[model samples]
Target: MISPVIPEDSRFESDPDEVLGDNHGLPAGWEVVPPDPADRFTVARLTHLLRAHERQGRGWAGSGVDDVLVEVSEHGLRTRENVVVRDPEGEIRAWGSVHDRSVGRMLFVHIVERGLDDDVAARCSDVLVEWAVGQAQAVGAARGLETQQIDTGAFQDDERQHAWLAGAGFERVRTWWQMTRPVTPEEAALAESPDHWEKDGVVFRLVRRSGSGLPDEDDLREVHEVLEGAFVDHFNSSEETFEEFLHRLREDPGHRWDHWWLAELTDGDAPQPVGALIGTVSESSSGPDGSYVSYLGVLEAARGRGVAKGLLATIISDAATRGRDRVGLEVDADSPTGAAGLYTSMGWTTKYVTESWHRDVRVSPA
Candidate 1:
């Protein structure tokens, strides 16, 4: 739901003031306004709303204040637009954010305060989705595309969310298994050390960083190339430029250069990049931090060579060595790679399930 900002789309802009100028079908006395992340009150209200939404949908909250703040931050605003719905009494009752994620995909967040009158809540959801559709077209036109896909997600158990998404013309397209594995001190031995490991003619190691702490550009490009090739046949895979890829990953609050890893097949005289794994730290306010696998990909040629398993093991070992409590990742429930089985074998278990909802909107000629 969160990522680094893409470059500003100046050609087809959605003016914030104009966004709220129209009711867009919101009930009388309710107003939609651009959110200011710098405002403590706004951030607090958004955080509270997110926690409320999460609690209602999944019985727990996984996002924090920082996560909310990131949505409306100046840097985030480069490729994102956010609005908060206020009731007659001037309290935020809903929040909607849209990201121009890539050329054909636009990410949307539809959040409405729980416990409101059912009709009012339903109307809020409708308005948010409608706005998202409009934004998708604007983003698509800016990219000179004919169609854009609105991609949003909902918890599998949240019937309310399911109904809202369905009513708004989105169809459930995919299911994901959110899995986690507890890290123990003993698991640190899974790898000889965190720096690098070689076995079966393959070498797995962290993405090289320079003396100034920036990752080597050559290595970064190779990692990107490996992932792009690996996912070419995967479901819903779209081509993202190297700049967009780096910007999005770097924007994560948990981004760590050292958490990035690459695997090379060294069977021949020259080592060839065959796989890449990008990880991030998942911080918890009340417990030890956890490691998260943000992205893991192995070239088709390297599939049977243990490249994916090696990358996963390296992250798990790195987590254990860092004293992290656990490692978390999301896998497509119907993945052709049989990744879920591999994760299960490595002691990971599904903690929750989430579904992706999508709507493809056509951009009208200007």
Candidate 2:
């Protein structure tokens, strides 16, 4: 099958000033190469190459490369790179790229180069930091930079990435724990709620895409509210518009309507869904069995009475029925409710840990 067509806005473009200029005072043989639309074959080759690096336990992977390329090409993003080093043959040895984001007038260093060797990787990382500082300066001059954010989750496994961030003058702002649970025949059987847990005033039901039909505007609005309210106090809590949330998920390679759920209290004259769990199956490198569980939330008022557990159990059963091998989710490491404990009790294991890093950017003087 042909690869999904990514719009022009998502691909990278060559920027002469940023790519050719001195990268934060480092001596350079670097050049920023745009994601040439005509270079589709090269991009695919790079994707496979990056995945190979990931399998060999390299710090970088290809999880979001497609999305990045698409954004650079079709989204009108001003992506820039600092070429810090080059081989004698002029091949790129070390470099980094910076792109803009929707929140917090910030620019993200999406890709950072660590040389092929460990010593070279360290040396290249140091130069990448300087380049990042320069990018911050440039962004501040142009758009009044608020903060510089780089997610090492895409590359670093755990504290290793954190150490690099700290060494680069970044601070750990948050922690995300990736959790996964195997879907077994037992889980499908266990999903049946006990009579005592069942309530006269409320009921739990599974919403299948085929059975219920496509989710309408009302369904999307309700789920949007559920997630907005659920994560209001969590780390990096920000209200995302309905359009933004839908757009982002729709862009995912694994998104499907069947993997979503909505819950409601049955006692009311007109019951509305008060909780939801939206998920997608990923056949990507990190997810082979098509992992699920993208976003799950329960309204504050709907807490207790087995709502959360019931929703989770229902989704797990759904995954099993659909022939999924495992379900995955990322939970805040410091949840006040100890959600990680809940997931653990339900059989999810800590597969890996990730850290979020942030650098406060000084806006250039007007």
Candidate 3:
């Protein structure tokens, strides 16, 4: 292979080895190999290219590639679960990764260069999908699950990737709106009636953490329990263990204990943690600096009593009091819960759209 015409952003000082997919007898200059920590810069460059083509660079933190590499390396994920397609001349044209997202599911991320010929792009995408499926099987084999599903997504406007997913046996599942609420500079000056939106008998509180600065297991479990009950009937909801929920969330760079809150009712004999709201420091994307609602879960017993609104008021008040720009969140586009409408009523708007695709794979646990 010849040396690559490295872009300033993609230049790499290298050290690497191993292949993740079936690379035998590949086209003259094309092959699939496992991702290496050394490939961080190249992957970032490819990510920027893929994202720019999909109009996704607006608020990206420029840390995706490095972050993924760190994730696979630092976590239990194997390098073999991620791959890069290189042209015969040492250029990275595509990258594919599969992350086991608890239960029997894996999240797939694949990026192919649009500048390549259609057939070339197709071939590369096909190889990446194949790799993702193989990784899914490996995940299933390890987890003792008889079957597993691979979940992936593309920008709602990216038809080519959608077609590739369909051809690979994935079905379009649902669309989500990346909604953001802009915090007006003057909103900070407005007095926030902390419990005004709260139900008459309910109280809101933050998840209590230990003096050691770690989240109390009891509190975290309650958060997970509340989320489980709240989203069990939601579209595409999966059965995930509490460990899975906490670990995956902790992986995010902005995760913090203080950002988690609860809606409780204690007027009775005991306090009931009926709803939970998990927020993270947001990377400003077309909005002033703010926080993002990663998960807002209200138990069935707590719905319709203004619990959702109360949880939001808590977040908005906290952000405003702290001088942050706004509080943002995403919602299901076709939710049966009228979630989108609720967000709109509360002043959140659809900023962008994303689509989800899913496919199943059956495997025997080793």
Best by TM-score: 1
Q: Which ten residues in a row have the lowest lDDT in candidate 3?
A: 10-19
lDDT (0 to 1) per candidate: 0.86, 0.59, 0.72
* Per-model TM against the reference: 0.96, 0.75, 0.85
lDDT of 3 by residue, 1-366 (tens): 112121222111111122232443347877776556555676566656556555642333334453554444535343225667888987878877677676777888888877788888888888777767666766677667788888998878778888898999999999889887866546543324432334577777777667777767788888889999999898778888776577667767778778888888867899898998999886545655588899999998878877788788778877776668767788988888888888899899887778889999887456
Better by TM-score, candidate 2 or 1: 1
- Where model 2 places Cα greater than 4 Å from the true spot, the runs are 1-28, 52-102, 105-160, 190-214, 284-288
Give each model's clash number.
0, 13, 0
Instruction: Give one digit per residue, the lDDT tens place, for model 2 in 123-228.
Output: 5567656556655655555544454344334334544445667887777667778788888756665455421123435555544333346656666667778888
Residue 25 shift from truth in candidate 1, angstroms = 3.1
TM-score, candidate number 3:
0.85
Rank list by lDDT: 1, 3, 2
Q: What is the lDDT of candidate 3?
A: 0.72
Candidate 2 vs. true structure, TM-score: 0.75
RMSD of 2: 5.7
Clashing pairs in 3: none
Which runs of model 3 end up more than 4 angstroms from their true locations? 1-26, 38-40, 56-71, 76-80, 185-199, 285-287, 364-366
lDDT of 1 by residue, 273-292 (tens): 99999999999989999999
**Model 3 clashing-pair count:** 0
